[model samples]
Target: MNTFRQHSKTRSRAVLVAGGAGFLGSTLCERLIADGERVICLDNMQTGTTGNLAALAREPRFSLVEQDVCDPVPRSLEVDAVFNLACAASPPRYQADPVHTMMTCVMGTHHLLDHCAAHGARFVQASTSEVYGDPREHPQREDYWGHVNPIGPRACYDEGKRAAETLCFDYRRGKGGGGAVDVRVARIFNTYGPRMRPDDGRIVSNLICQALADQPLTIYGTGEQTRSFCYVDDMIEGLVRLMRVDPAPDGPVNLGNPGEFTILELAEMVLDLVETTSRVAHEPLPTDDPQRRRPDVSRAETHLGWRPTTPLSAGLPPTIDWFAGLVQHRRADRRAPVAEASALHGVA
Candidate 1:
């Protein structure tokens, strides 16, 4: 446990964000720190990057712990709350190592639940809309059991999250052999914003990166598959509200914007935002890809009083700018080595 040396006085709260160096986790860490909470960011750095935490480099209230959540947490560490955002969320990344992804969702969640049970800390499980796999429900509500194929290529992530949700409720029901743990589960939908990795195979990042790089925006399948998008800031607010809401909700609450759009609509929007010669290209849809996904966030609104405020029109601009900056930086970095080699060869 790294101590906050500068703040001699104890802070109001200490929150541990597992997978905190990742896209959403890093943003949550920044928000918590800005809200005057001491944050212990635990991550294995598998899909996460250290550059995401650069903003907090000099902040004493923030500490980064490089470790896998599947392992037992240190007994000495104490926190008021724990946000389990540990597993790889993207399909390409999670499917790359299916077994590890499953273990991270199951064992990693078990470890965190145990820690929270012992410490009497509130726990927030960042379950996903994927749990509602290829959902038959028009607008997926918390009660939907999901239409997941247990043995499909994407089953690793879909089933893993479902298992994690089971663990959370089990702990909450005191079935894990101890007092009931305070637990909240948020079924997050498609969220996008800054800090998203260009290589992440999500639609938002994919189209944005391709447009920035002058490559064709690949649309999977017929491009009519619909999905709801929530801004990262809005998602963070929902999570915070879920954590602090009185009397934790009995079941998972959907946290996302209900405004839905097709993949073609998103690609068109991205192309319009970015100044590039990129055109739309069709491709084979991956296995178990959901045709339509729109969260019914009535549960979130009723319980947490949270509803997404940012529209896609408002959100995509900043997201494009962030990806554009990253694309530029990467291009510059790649050229630097070549330039150095050319200089060494005296090839002006």
Candidate 2:
């Protein structure tokens, strides 16, 4: 195995972001390019879309490699660090193909770790709060063993991530004789922001899109179940800090805003921001959905000196505006064909 090469001071460091076409991945790619680093984005385009990378299309330092992480990563590509953000995150997408989701989390992670080990690059795993499914603990701490259901429908993602974390630590300990790979695990909580897909089925997107379209907002369960939201910018900052911090944190760090809000509160907030007559419509909660989820970010604060600075009030407007634009664009697209057809009939 080749020792990790230290780039010369004059050269920009190359960072590979797996799943780079996704919302968070594309955003991270932009950030790296802006920071004077060369970025290589690897994505399968399954849950990710090329539209998300529009901003970076002309950037000379940014390049995209379309491929799945479960496949063998090309050895010719050189990267100083690797950020694995490759899995289908939202329930609708992940559950659509459960087997692939499991493979992406477990086998995908294994492939990336092996690549990192060979190149001597740092690896960062974007683990989710789902690992702590239906927690009995109020605010989940890293050490708390999650209360996840192993055989349920959600198990493909939740359990797969848990197993991926295991692989990361095992590689870190050099348990199987390949040299230890520098690995960092971040348990990300609910994150929302501009690039989010309007139909992704996340609560923020669901409420914002419905409100914009004057459709009823779907509130699962009694709307009493709570979650903490972290704006995407803040979440990305936390990930960057974790990757660059001096000594790798000995354990996983919870990266999320600690401010808790009920589903009703979030819906009301969206209604207030969007000028629409949309009202709340309650729906049955999905199985294994946690009743309450707020991260215990003490570890991130103490170790990474990071805390989410954007409040919901500040974040929601931009998010709502983005969705509104998308809705309008979609409506315009729908009208275009009809308009063309009418003009053709007139010419006839």
Best by TM-score: 2
lDDT of 2 by residue, 52-85 (tens): 7766665678777878999988988877899999
Q: What lDDT, from 0 to 1, does candidate 2 have?
A: 0.87
Worst 10 residues of 2 by lDDT: 339-348
Cα displacement (Å) at residue 38, model 1:
0.7
Residue 329 in candidate 2, Cα distance off native in Å: 1.5
> After superposition, which runs of candidate 1 have C-alpha atoms over 4 Å from their true positions?
1-10, 331-348
- Write candidate 1's Cα lDDT for 1-348 as tens digits: 112222336455779999988899999999998888888888898877767777776577877777898899886778778999998999899999999999999999999999888777889999999998998888888898999999999998999999999999999988877567889999999999998888888999999999988999999999999999999999999999999887889999999999999999999999888999999999999999999999998989899989999999999999999988887666422212433322211100
Residue clash pairs of candidate 2: none
Off by over 4 Å in 2: 1-5, 331-348
- Residue 46 of model 1 has an lDDT of 89
Kindly provide the TM-score of model 1 when superposed on the true structure, using C-alpha atoms: 0.92
Model 1 sits at a Cα RMSD from the real structure of 7.0
